[model samples]
Target: MPQETFTLQIRQIRLETDDVLSFELASPTQNPLPVAPAGAHLELHLPGALQRSYSLLDEGLGGCYRIAVKREPQSRGGSAWLHSQARVGQTLQAQAPRNDFALNEHAPESILIAGGIGITPLLAMARRLNRLGHRWSLHYAAPSPDRMAYRDCLQALAADGHGSLHTYCSSEDRRLDIAAVVRASGPQAHLYCCGPAGLIDDFITATQDRPPERVHYERFAARHAASTEGGYEALLARSGKTVKVSAGRTLLDAILDAGVDIPYACSQGVCGTCRTRVISGTPDHRDECLTEAERQSNEAIIPCCSGALSSTLVLDL
Candidate 1:
């Protein structure tokens, strides 16, 4: 099944940094969009079927949703199009906002780490925390000050006693030490990080001693390298259909080719949209969303980047 979508008009576009642009989006009819919580993301239906997800900033900004994008010349077309072609007053189709990186404003302590353009969602969390008078801090890092987005806003938030801001710019000889930061935080502090793959991996490794519930992260791209070494059968228990996953092919494509409908976004498995229940069989979990305990239970699977450890997987499609 497809998600419901609506038209959003680009009201403003501001250069946040050298490569990052902030887009302000609102309903075409000037209606207020749904109240998006901190860390929520909106899926933009771009031209050429290139759907991309961007983090919704914390502030509503008078009912308009704000998002920041960093132009990636080497990657897919989303960022490139938005940077070189998109203009204010243009309308775009978008899916309803969804959140996998929700912030816990009530936590006793919140520590946010952002690298480069990954500051999008954490900026929202900082504002919400400031408004609620909660204790929080943001550590933002970029190669240079010219590339750090939201520097003024974050500085203002800190200057007003809302929260504290710490910045690290490699060009100035200050480097962010993830392990040191993790070691310094209190054990109970709810840590959140969104950044490059190396940063996320370092954050996870540094926080391994803390309670899993207290550590959180969001990735714009999949961390795991998906393998196509399939030698299993996916049995759709409810539909009474079986799809043979042969080597050099993915189970998701095979199942979809068999005329089965499965909702998926970010085919890379960073998004948990395709998580499905497993009636039986152990899943070779590769998704970043599933916790270790869930993988051990073998009760669910993310077929987008996962496969079966067992010869047959009875899926509850």
Candidate 2:
């Protein structure tokens, strides 16, 4: 299915930090927006056909959506454009909320670990957990207090005894011990983390002994793809066509260039929207969406970022 775009009026804008800004969006006609779960995200369709995803932070707020944007020093103009050009009273187009990191409500306990801007989704999780009277804790880390968003709100939660809030500011020589945090969560606790590659990697390593289904995480960016020496052939079984997937180009791009239409979001392969059945092929899977079992089955491929291990790959469509 194709994504439907809706216009959102910017209701408020606030500077959360030196490099971060929070934007509040509402339907132009005051209609109620779709309610999203704890860890859902909205895709903002920016100018020049650029789309960027931001975690929805307005947990308890109805009829409104809130998101925080952090200006990346090395951004390709997305954050910079929002920080400089976006303003209150302006209307922007956005897609409906979607979740790839959903909280397990039935878990005995929940542990949320957030780093810097990664706090967006975790904040929502905290609020939802508090509302449901569920046991949860948040471990937030940032370079400094000045760079952290929603500090006062998190502190308020701590003061109200909703849950424990442990903060680590690297500038103050406080480092987050991932191993200790995981161990402290206990065996029955469900752990969720979102952050830079280093923090996520360490968290995964620390929790390696635990059940894989009990640990969840989401990454803002995809890992760098390894280089391939030559191009591969992709056969579109339904269309009865063969396209060459170039060394540097993705299988998705090759298919699109051949005039095939497909549904896709977060072309980086994190959304699992571009997953297509594999008629016959050994896929060199690079997507984070598939699990070990799915990868081993070779039943589908996320063409947006994955490639073929065999010389010729045949796809269902």
Candidate 3:
């Protein structure tokens, strides 16, 4: 399936809180909005910045497209740029929606756990679940009511509907009761969570007894421990250039730093953006998007998150 990337001007920007904004992009563009399910996210190519991924909050039917973004205290510059600087009427390049967190049709009950900004994707799931009248529950954890995105709307939906929505103000409470929520779910219920790495780790631990396939997780950051040795050099066969990327930096970063552009999204590796043909070299795969066969072939790897394991890896570029 080919994705249609389009440039749209920002139609509106609503401040959800001090740092979060619910951005609305113009809908009537050259490429029409496709029908996207809950958990679908778009890859944004910020002006003069690396590609960043954001979950789609609004359904495709709306005349406008909405996405909620929270400014991170220690961001790599993407969120900070969007939160503090990106203005309405500015044009931004965005790719078509990609969904890796769709609801499990086999699941009788859906349990969503969100932490802080992680609520963006899960909120979409709640919307579809509510409309479908499915058995579902959401546990949203934030520092306070003010920090919660879409507070009034989420609360109203939860109150007026059958789905149970629970909020945990972590500033008031020491920690969210993950154990309780996991234990409360029925044996066959599906668990979907997206948040900080700590919450994800804890959730995985709590569900150790459950089947692994039933538990779906989305990580926002790189969890791999840093490499002990120095970084390796990359050889772009198609471009005929040799670039050096440090251990802390990624192959995609090095290529971009060299003024070369390649397709990429969700630098986290889940979006399969920045995927390119690996002509040669052993790649240190860190992405969660590729399948076992894809990895075994060593033909395609997500350069955004993956690095070269060999001294000199060649990419089609």
Candidate 4:
């Protein structure tokens, strides 16, 4: 089915912390919104073509969508705009919820690890697991207690014995040992992590020996590494055009320069929106969204941040 768009009115805006704020959006006509499962996110279509993806924090809340946004000092304007211009009475356009970091609900035991603003999605997972009486634990790490967004709710979950909550505060000299936490979760438990690249990389490295399917993660941003050497040629099959993708220029930009239209959001390679079918060619596969199996298949490529390995490539588009 094609994705749907809706206009929602901001009913409430509550500050979760010094830098984070939670916005509750509801249908303007008081109609029920689409039901979004835990770990789902919505793409907000802000003014000036500034689109940003935010995770929904509503685990059990009904008929509305809740999202927490953290203001980033070095933001590309999305967070800053929301923090400064968004108001309770304002209406915003947003895409329906989509889940790229879905939880494995059938797992007997689950382990959740979060860092900073990454806790938004995990918080919903924790709530669902607790309500369903599933065995789970959460480990949240932040710079300090004042920076943690949902401290009170997490504490209440721990107090109720629904799940164990372990917090690490860098100001208090506490460290989150990724290896220790992964090892303690046991081999059969499913692990979900969302955080900074360094933390996610550490967890991935620590769990390399474990079953790959048992470990899941979501990254907030793309890892900007040194580009590969040389330029490549991309053949747009549908457009009957050939475009030169320079080493400094991304494939998506090259294609667009050739007068081809492709849909994309979060050009950082974290979102799978720019995923395009590869009729033929070897993709360099720099994107963080695709799984190992998907990368190995070479059936699709995320053009926004990924490049081609072969000199000449063919794209379905």
Candidate 5:
């Protein structure tokens, strides 16, 4: 797989519905898209917009990369800019592909549950599985069929006899039952889910009894925020260097300000690229990338966007 910077032109942009836009980005070169897994996402640097992570929707071939963007009315300009400001023919900087969510290699069957825009990554997975002629099923739940992104693509997959695709529209019917569907999916099936907070929470609660390791999930929203010092001190362990960051400044910013270079992306803490070992002090882990156990162990921290709570944090640097 190739990992190189590319400028992608917005060859086409279609409003799938009032809240979603299906953007088909034209590649600059002829190389095929990297072989991305089910839950892989790319970092997009939209001009004048903050770096945001978007799940890859393309099947890793074709001349273009497709992504579905949901208009986030509550976001701080990320989704809003993507929906309102982005125009066709415009080019944007984007990274190739990265995967945090992958499939269970040895599993015989898999079940995919998607909520709203969370369907983007799973859609890619479904396409890949269909291409390989594998056994899988997808249950997609949305507020309405009109608001559902990539409805045509998913429909085509179902039409081709790839797998069963279930659509649950909650607007017209008050009794959209996801629990029953999940229950019938059977045990030993590798399950993957993505989407909004309410849906993710419901699914997590619904399938809590499943094998803890088999349930793979990812959050599109930022994780919990704690009352850290607003900012704190980061000590470079090897160099014996110290940098003070006030409220609003991240530990990565403080280190880079002191002429230290650390790899990072999606500074919002979604990508685990900037994760470094925590040598000492209390780490106020605020990243969406690490699990609860990883944070508790104090083994690593994403300093690029994470902060310190103990006033002084020693980093492996």
Candidate 6:
């Protein structure tokens, strides 16, 4: 099946932070925008073939989707254009919502780690957990107090007794101790991390010994044109085909570039459209679409964002 294309109109824009703007997008033709769960993202097709994926901060029954965009210091035209040129009532093109990060409703508790603008998806998870009367905690880090987005909402969640919110500001000489946080979590608590590559790497290191089923993460595509998660060899079984995916390259991109056809929609591991079988090797499971059981089995891999935890992944291609 093909993904749906939508004509979205920017209905409103709210200033989230000094550098962040939250846009309220709705379909201009009264067509309902795709409903997305917490931790979902939508790809906005902008001018000059500039397509960028944004975390869906709010998905309402009123056919409106809210997403936050932070003006990157480098400004590669996606966030910069949204900040400068995107206007209310102007129509834009986008894909249906997809999620690479999703909350685990079944876990006894959730431990969320976020850095900078990475709060977008985690905020949604906090709200969902609150709505469901679940216990959760958020460890958020930012440059300064003012730089944190949705601080009021997170504080409100704390006030409402939905979750605990902890802030660590680097400017104040405070930092989130990944090891300490992981060490403090209960056994059944699922851990989720989405932030800068460095933060993610630290989180992974701290939780490496934990059950693979209990850890969930999403890649932050704002930086790192290739995967910063390291790289390895992908050996296709049938033709004995092999591609050495570099530290900066993704398995999906490398496979496609090799003219090896693999159907994939959202290259961020949300859609589950590109799930491939793994005959051998441990996969660095980073997709929300797969369950804990699936990950524990280590029988499949979402090649888009996921990589080989082992040096070589034997694909049953």
Residue lDDT tens for model 3, 118-231: 988888888888787787888989888888888777887787565888888977774688889999999999999999889998998988899877888787875764232437
What is the C-alpha local distance difference test score of each model?
0.86, 0.85, 0.80, 0.86, 0.77, 0.83
Model 2 bad stretches (over 4 Å)? 226-230, 237-241
Every model's TM-score: 0.93, 0.92, 0.84, 0.92, 0.87, 0.75
- Model 5 residue runs over 4 Å out of place are 1-4, 174-176, 237-240, 256-267, 309-311
lDDT of 2 by residue, 1-317 (tens): 34688889999999999999999999989987877889998888787766777898855277899999999998766798899999889998888888889999888899999999999999988888888778888999999999989988998876666688989999999989989999888799999999898898899899999999999998866675722433789999989999988777788888888998766767777767678999998998888777779999999998888888899899988
Clashes of each: 0, 0, 1, 0, 0, 1
Q: Which is the better candidate, 4 or 6, if ranked by lDDT?
A: 4
Per-residue C-alpha lDDT of model 6 across residues 80-116, encoded as one tens digit per residue? 8899888899988888777767677878989999999
Candidate ranking (lDDT, best to worst):
1, 4, 2, 6, 3, 5
lDDT comparing candidate 2 with the true structure: 0.85
Best by TM-score: 1
lDDT of 6 at 184: 99
* Per-residue C-alpha lDDT of model 4 across residues 148-232, encoded as one tens digit per residue: 9998998887677768999999999998998999888877999999999998999899889889889989999888642344389
- lDDT per residue for candidate 5 within 64-104, as digits (tens), equals 77888888778766788888889988888877667887766
In model 1, the Cα lDDT at residue 130 comes to 86
Off by over 4 Å in 4: 1-3, 226-230, 239-241
